[model samples]
Target: MVIEYSGIVVRSVLTDKREKFYDSKGIGCYMFRIDEAEVVDATMHGSAARFINHSCEPNCYSRVIHVEGHKRIVIFALRRILRGEELTYDYKFPIEEPAAKLPCNCGARRCRRFLN
Candidate 1:
Protein backbone atom coordinates (compact mmCIF):
# COMPACT_ATOMS: atom_id res chain seq x y z
CA MET A 1 0.00 0.00 0.00
CA VAL A 2 0.97 3.65 -0.37
CA ILE A 3 0.56 6.44 2.15
CA GLU A 4 -0.31 9.78 0.67
CA TYR A 5 0.98 12.77 2.56
CA SER A 6 0.48 16.16 1.04
CA GLY A 7 1.53 15.37 -2.53
CA ILE A 8 4.10 12.74 -1.63
CA VAL A 9 3.43 9.01 -1.86
CA VAL A 10 5.17 7.13 0.91
CA ARG A 11 5.30 3.35 1.14
CA SER A 12 3.25 1.37 3.69
CA VAL A 13 4.33 -1.74 5.51
CA LEU A 14 2.69 -4.59 7.44
CA THR A 15 4.52 -7.11 9.59
CA ASP A 16 3.92 -9.68 12.29
CA LYS A 17 4.15 -7.20 15.14
CA ARG A 18 1.28 -4.88 14.25
CA GLU A 19 -0.33 -5.82 17.57
CA LYS A 20 2.22 -3.74 19.38
CA PHE A 21 1.19 -0.95 17.03
CA TYR A 22 4.83 -0.70 15.87
CA ASP A 23 7.79 -2.97 15.39
CA SER A 24 11.28 -2.45 14.08
CA LYS A 25 12.36 -4.90 11.40
CA GLY A 26 16.04 -4.34 12.01
CA ILE A 27 15.04 -1.32 9.99
CA GLY A 28 12.43 1.17 11.19
CA CYS A 29 8.71 1.79 11.43
CA TYR A 30 6.99 4.99 10.44
CA MET A 31 4.37 6.01 12.98
CA PHE A 32 1.44 8.40 12.88
CA ARG A 33 0.79 10.35 16.05
CA ILE A 34 -2.23 9.65 18.25
CA ASP A 35 -3.92 12.92 17.41
CA GLU A 36 -4.08 11.72 13.81
CA ALA A 37 -6.68 9.12 14.70
CA GLU A 38 -9.29 8.76 17.40
CA VAL A 39 -8.81 5.07 18.21
CA VAL A 40 -5.04 5.11 18.43
CA ASP A 41 -2.94 6.76 21.05
CA ALA A 42 -0.20 9.31 20.38
CA THR A 43 1.24 6.73 17.95
CA MET A 44 -0.16 4.62 15.15
CA HIS A 45 1.63 2.04 13.03
CA GLY A 46 2.87 2.63 9.50
CA SER A 47 1.91 -0.66 7.95
CA ALA A 48 3.68 -0.13 4.64
CA ALA A 49 6.98 1.12 5.97
CA ARG A 50 10.05 -0.82 4.80
CA PHE A 51 12.60 -2.77 6.71
CA ILE A 52 15.81 -0.88 6.17
CA ASN A 53 18.78 -2.39 7.92
CA HIS A 54 20.42 -0.57 10.79
CA SER A 55 23.73 1.35 10.62
CA CYS A 56 25.63 3.34 13.20
CA GLU A 57 26.40 5.78 10.47
CA PRO A 58 22.97 5.96 8.91
CA ASN A 59 21.94 7.58 5.67
CA CYS A 60 18.35 8.19 6.76
CA TYR A 61 16.83 9.81 9.81
CA SER A 62 13.36 9.70 11.32
CA ARG A 63 11.62 12.95 12.13
CA VAL A 64 8.35 13.66 13.86
CA ILE A 65 6.27 16.44 12.42
CA HIS A 66 2.89 17.95 13.15
CA VAL A 67 0.59 17.61 10.15
CA GLU A 68 -3.06 18.59 10.19
CA GLY A 69 -2.81 18.73 13.99
CA HIS A 70 -1.32 15.24 14.07
CA LYS A 71 2.22 14.17 14.72
CA ARG A 72 3.69 11.95 12.01
CA ILE A 73 6.95 10.13 11.71
CA VAL A 74 8.85 10.68 8.50
CA ILE A 75 12.05 9.12 7.33
CA PHE A 76 14.20 11.71 5.67
CA ALA A 77 17.07 10.98 3.36
CA LEU A 78 20.09 12.42 5.09
CA ARG A 79 22.13 11.32 2.09
CA ARG A 80 21.35 10.11 -1.39
CA ILE A 81 19.20 6.96 -1.29
CA LEU A 82 19.80 4.81 -4.33
CA ARG A 83 17.00 2.82 -5.93
CA GLY A 84 16.38 -0.54 -4.21
CA GLU A 85 18.28 0.68 -1.18
CA GLU A 86 16.93 -0.31 2.22
CA LEU A 87 16.00 2.68 4.38
CA THR A 88 17.54 2.84 7.84
CA TYR A 89 17.65 5.20 10.82
CA ASP A 90 19.58 5.43 14.05
CA TYR A 91 17.53 3.73 16.78
CA LYS A 92 19.71 5.07 19.52
CA PHE A 93 18.36 8.34 20.81
CA PRO A 94 21.38 9.67 22.71
CA ILE A 95 24.00 8.49 25.16
CA GLU A 96 22.08 9.95 28.11
CA GLU A 97 18.70 8.74 26.88
CA PRO A 98 19.51 5.24 25.75
CA ALA A 99 16.92 2.67 24.63
CA ALA A 100 17.11 -1.02 25.26
CA LYS A 101 19.41 -3.10 23.05
CA LEU A 102 18.31 -5.72 20.53
CA PRO A 103 20.37 -8.23 18.59
CA CYS A 104 21.90 -6.65 15.52
CA ASN A 105 23.01 -8.26 12.27
CA CYS A 106 23.46 -4.94 10.41
CA GLY A 107 27.16 -5.54 9.62
CA ALA A 108 28.11 -1.87 9.45
CA ARG A 109 31.68 -0.89 10.27
CA ARG A 110 30.37 0.75 13.43
CA CYS A 111 27.49 -1.53 14.35
CA ARG A 112 25.80 -0.79 17.66
CA ARG A 113 25.31 -3.33 20.42
CA PHE A 114 21.58 -3.34 19.70
CA LEU A 115 19.13 -2.27 17.01
CA ASN A 116 16.59 -0.70 19.52
Candidate 2:
Protein backbone atom coordinates (compact mmCIF):
# COMPACT_ATOMS: atom_id res chain seq x y z
CA MET A 1 0.00 0.00 0.00
CA VAL A 2 1.21 3.47 -0.76
CA ILE A 3 -0.59 5.14 2.11
CA GLU A 4 -3.72 5.32 4.16
CA TYR A 5 -6.12 8.13 3.24
CA SER A 6 -6.34 9.31 6.81
CA GLY A 7 -8.65 11.91 8.32
CA ILE A 8 -11.47 12.44 10.75
CA VAL A 9 -14.22 9.94 10.06
CA VAL A 10 -17.63 11.56 9.81
CA ARG A 11 -21.16 10.68 8.94
CA SER A 12 -22.02 11.24 5.28
CA VAL A 13 -24.87 13.51 6.37
CA LEU A 14 -22.45 15.93 8.04
CA THR A 15 -20.22 16.39 5.00
CA ASP A 16 -22.25 19.24 3.54
CA LYS A 17 -22.11 21.22 6.75
CA ARG A 18 -18.38 20.63 7.13
CA GLU A 19 -17.68 21.55 3.51
CA LYS A 20 -19.62 24.78 3.87
CA PHE A 21 -17.77 25.58 7.06
CA TYR A 22 -14.41 25.06 5.37
CA ASP A 23 -15.47 27.14 2.41
CA SER A 24 -16.50 29.96 4.70
CA LYS A 25 -13.07 29.78 6.31
CA GLY A 26 -11.34 29.81 2.93
CA ILE A 27 -9.72 26.46 3.62
CA GLY A 28 -9.58 23.90 0.87
CA CYS A 29 -11.46 20.75 1.66
CA TYR A 30 -10.22 17.21 1.04
CA MET A 31 -12.59 14.33 1.39
CA PHE A 32 -12.80 10.61 0.56
CA ARG A 33 -16.09 8.86 0.71
CA ILE A 34 -16.00 5.33 2.08
CA ASP A 35 -19.62 4.58 1.35
CA GLU A 36 -23.09 6.09 1.59
CA ALA A 37 -22.82 6.16 5.36
CA GLU A 38 -19.30 7.52 5.98
CA VAL A 39 -16.67 9.89 4.65
CA VAL A 40 -13.16 10.83 5.64
CA ASP A 41 -12.78 14.56 6.10
CA ALA A 42 -9.18 15.30 5.23
CA THR A 43 -9.42 19.07 5.12
CA MET A 44 -7.71 19.82 8.40
CA HIS A 45 -6.22 16.50 9.35
CA GLY A 46 -4.59 14.73 6.45
CA SER A 47 -1.34 13.47 5.06
CA ALA A 48 0.50 14.22 1.85
CA ALA A 49 -1.65 11.53 0.28
CA ARG A 50 -4.50 14.01 0.35
CA PHE A 51 -2.73 16.02 -2.32
CA ILE A 52 -2.48 13.16 -4.80
CA ASN A 53 -4.15 14.07 -8.07
CA HIS A 54 -6.49 12.09 -10.30
CA SER A 55 -5.58 10.33 -13.56
CA CYS A 56 -7.62 8.55 -16.18
CA GLU A 57 -5.04 5.81 -16.32
CA PRO A 58 -3.65 5.70 -12.85
CA ASN A 59 -0.58 4.01 -11.43
CA CYS A 60 -2.37 3.63 -8.14
CA TYR A 61 -5.83 2.63 -6.95
CA SER A 62 -7.72 2.95 -3.73
CA ARG A 63 -9.45 0.25 -1.76
CA VAL A 64 -11.67 0.18 1.29
CA ILE A 65 -10.48 -2.15 4.03
CA HIS A 66 -12.15 -3.09 7.27
CA VAL A 67 -9.79 -3.03 10.20
CA GLU A 68 -10.93 -3.54 13.76
CA GLY A 69 -14.49 -3.21 12.58
CA HIS A 70 -13.89 0.25 11.08
CA LYS A 71 -13.56 0.89 7.38
CA ARG A 72 -10.51 2.69 5.96
CA ILE A 73 -9.47 3.85 2.54
CA VAL A 74 -6.00 2.84 1.40
CA ILE A 75 -4.07 3.78 -1.70
CA PHE A 76 -2.14 0.97 -3.28
CA ALA A 77 0.12 0.67 -6.28
CA LEU A 78 -1.60 -0.69 -9.36
CA ARG A 79 1.82 -1.51 -10.80
CA ARG A 80 5.48 -0.79 -10.27
CA ILE A 81 6.16 2.86 -9.54
CA LEU A 82 9.49 4.46 -10.14
CA ARG A 83 11.09 6.80 -7.64
CA GLY A 84 10.21 10.50 -8.04
CA GLU A 85 7.10 9.66 -10.06
CA GLU A 86 3.90 11.41 -9.13
CA LEU A 87 1.27 9.17 -7.60
CA THR A 88 -2.21 9.21 -9.03
CA TYR A 89 -5.48 7.32 -8.94
CA ASP A 90 -8.88 7.52 -10.59
CA TYR A 91 -11.34 9.55 -8.57
CA LYS A 92 -14.27 7.70 -10.09
CA PHE A 93 -16.67 10.50 -9.40
CA PRO A 94 -20.23 9.84 -10.37
CA ILE A 95 -21.31 11.09 -13.79
CA GLU A 96 -23.29 14.32 -13.82
CA GLU A 97 -25.22 16.42 -16.29
CA PRO A 98 -23.41 18.20 -19.09
CA ALA A 99 -23.88 21.52 -17.34
CA ALA A 100 -22.40 20.13 -14.13
CA LYS A 101 -19.54 18.08 -15.57
CA LEU A 102 -16.03 18.51 -14.19
CA PRO A 103 -13.27 18.55 -16.79
CA CYS A 104 -10.36 16.14 -16.57
CA ASN A 105 -6.83 17.54 -16.84
CA CYS A 106 -4.76 14.45 -16.27
CA GLY A 107 -3.58 14.58 -19.87
CA ALA A 108 -3.57 10.82 -20.34
CA ARG A 109 -3.96 9.62 -23.93
CA ARG A 110 -7.15 7.87 -22.86
CA CYS A 111 -8.43 10.73 -20.75
CA ARG A 112 -12.22 10.84 -20.77
CA ARG A 113 -12.07 14.65 -21.01
CA PHE A 114 -14.46 14.89 -18.09
CA LEU A 115 -13.69 13.76 -14.58
CA ASN A 116 -17.21 12.47 -14.06
Candidate 3:
Protein backbone atom coordinates (compact mmCIF):
# COMPACT_ATOMS: atom_id res chain seq x y z
CA MET A 1 0.00 0.00 0.00
CA VAL A 2 1.09 3.57 -0.60
CA ILE A 3 1.78 5.76 2.43
CA GLU A 4 2.45 9.50 2.44
CA TYR A 5 4.75 11.00 5.08
CA SER A 6 4.35 14.43 6.63
CA GLY A 7 5.91 16.46 9.48
CA ILE A 8 7.05 19.88 10.71
CA VAL A 9 10.42 21.41 9.92
CA VAL A 10 12.64 22.69 12.68
CA ARG A 11 16.12 24.11 12.89
CA SER A 12 18.76 21.64 14.09
CA VAL A 13 21.48 22.13 16.60
CA LEU A 14 24.62 23.00 14.72
CA THR A 15 27.49 20.56 14.84
CA ASP A 16 30.73 22.00 13.60
CA LYS A 17 32.45 20.29 10.72
CA ARG A 18 30.82 16.99 11.47
CA GLU A 19 29.21 14.74 8.90
CA LYS A 20 26.92 13.02 11.38
CA PHE A 21 25.31 13.56 14.78
CA TYR A 22 23.65 10.90 16.92
CA ASP A 23 21.73 11.28 20.16
CA SER A 24 20.88 8.18 22.12
CA LYS A 25 18.21 9.82 24.25
CA GLY A 26 17.18 12.97 22.46
CA ILE A 27 14.08 13.47 20.34
CA GLY A 28 16.29 14.43 17.46
CA CYS A 29 16.86 11.61 14.98
CA TYR A 30 17.89 12.52 11.46
CA MET A 31 20.09 15.49 10.75
CA PHE A 32 19.89 17.19 7.39
CA ARG A 33 23.60 17.41 6.66
CA ILE A 34 23.73 20.62 4.70
CA ASP A 35 27.43 20.48 4.21
CA GLU A 36 30.73 19.63 5.90
CA ALA A 37 30.01 22.20 8.61
CA GLU A 38 26.25 22.68 8.56
CA VAL A 39 23.37 20.40 9.57
CA VAL A 40 19.67 21.07 9.95
CA ASP A 41 18.12 19.12 12.81
CA ALA A 42 14.88 17.77 11.41
CA THR A 43 13.77 16.44 14.79
CA MET A 44 13.73 19.74 16.68
CA HIS A 45 10.73 21.07 14.82
CA GLY A 46 8.03 19.39 16.91
CA SER A 47 7.14 17.00 14.16
CA ALA A 48 5.80 13.47 14.70
CA ALA A 49 8.47 12.29 12.30
CA ARG A 50 11.02 12.74 15.07
CA PHE A 51 9.40 9.91 16.97
CA ILE A 52 9.91 7.42 14.17
CA ASN A 53 12.39 4.78 15.32
CA HIS A 54 15.43 3.38 13.57
CA SER A 55 16.02 -0.06 12.09
CA CYS A 56 18.93 -1.67 10.31
CA GLU A 57 16.58 -3.12 7.76
CA PRO A 58 14.07 -0.35 7.42
CA ASN A 59 10.81 -0.30 5.52
CA CYS A 60 11.29 3.44 4.98
CA TYR A 61 14.15 5.68 3.91
CA SER A 62 14.94 9.35 4.51
CA ARG A 63 15.43 11.55 1.50
CA VAL A 64 16.69 15.11 1.29
CA ILE A 65 14.40 17.54 -0.42
CA HIS A 66 14.98 21.18 -1.20
CA VAL A 67 12.26 23.78 -0.93
CA GLU A 68 12.64 27.56 -1.10
CA GLY A 69 16.42 27.01 -1.00
CA HIS A 70 16.24 25.14 2.29
CA LYS A 71 17.06 21.46 2.61
CA ARG A 72 14.52 19.22 4.26
CA ILE A 73 14.63 15.58 5.28
CA VAL A 74 11.62 13.42 4.48
CA ILE A 75 10.81 9.77 5.09
CA PHE A 76 9.34 7.62 2.34
CA ALA A 77 8.05 4.09 2.45
CA LEU A 78 10.13 1.50 0.62
CA ARG A 79 7.51 -1.24 0.57
CA ARG A 80 4.00 -2.08 1.63
CA ILE A 81 3.40 -1.52 5.35
CA LEU A 82 0.46 -3.11 7.04
CA ARG A 83 -1.56 -1.07 9.48
CA GLY A 84 -0.22 -0.92 13.07
CA GLU A 85 3.35 -1.51 11.93
CA GLU A 86 5.80 0.90 13.51
CA LEU A 87 7.33 3.36 11.08
CA THR A 88 11.11 3.08 10.85
CA TYR A 89 14.09 4.28 8.86
CA ASP A 90 17.83 3.88 8.93
CA TYR A 91 19.63 6.51 10.95
CA LYS A 92 22.84 5.94 8.97
CA PHE A 93 24.91 7.90 11.44
CA PRO A 94 28.56 7.89 10.48
CA ILE A 95 30.81 5.44 12.27
CA GLU A 96 33.98 7.29 13.08
CA GLU A 97 35.04 6.35 16.61
CA PRO A 98 34.44 3.26 18.68
CA ALA A 99 32.42 5.38 21.09
CA ALA A 100 29.96 6.04 18.29
CA LYS A 101 28.84 2.44 18.40
CA LEU A 102 25.32 2.12 19.79
CA PRO A 103 23.47 -1.08 20.60
CA CYS A 104 20.53 -1.96 18.38
CA ASN A 105 17.12 -3.05 19.62
CA CYS A 106 15.32 -2.87 16.32
CA GLY A 107 15.06 -6.70 16.10
CA ALA A 108 15.14 -6.72 12.33
CA ARG A 109 16.33 -9.88 10.62
CA ARG A 110 19.58 -8.15 9.65
CA CYS A 111 20.31 -6.46 12.98
CA ARG A 112 23.67 -4.72 12.67
CA ARG A 113 24.78 -5.41 16.31
CA PHE A 114 25.53 -1.71 16.69
CA LEU A 115 24.18 1.43 15.18
CA ASN A 116 26.70 3.77 13.64
RMSD of each: 8.3, 0.8, 5.1
Q: Per-residue lDDT of 15-87 in model 3, one digit per residue for the tens? A: 5222243454443354445445446554554356666788999889987766799665667889988899998
Q: Which wins on lDDT, candidate 1 or candidate 3?
A: 3
What lDDT score goes with residue 32 in model 1? 32
lDDT per residue for candidate 2 within 8-116, as digits (tens), equals 9999999999999999999999999999999999889987889999999999999999999989899999999999999999999998888999999999999999889
How many angstroms is residue 46 displaced in model 1 relative to the true structure, after the best TM-score fit?
3.5
TM-score of each: 0.52, 0.96, 0.68
Q: Order of all candidates by lDDT, from best down to worst?
A: 2, 3, 1
Q: What is the C-alpha lDDT of each candidate?
A: 0.49, 0.95, 0.65
lDDT of 1 at 9: 27
Judged by lDDT, which candidate is best? 2
Error of 1 at 71 (Å): 0.6
Q: How many clashes show up per model?
A: 8, 0, 1
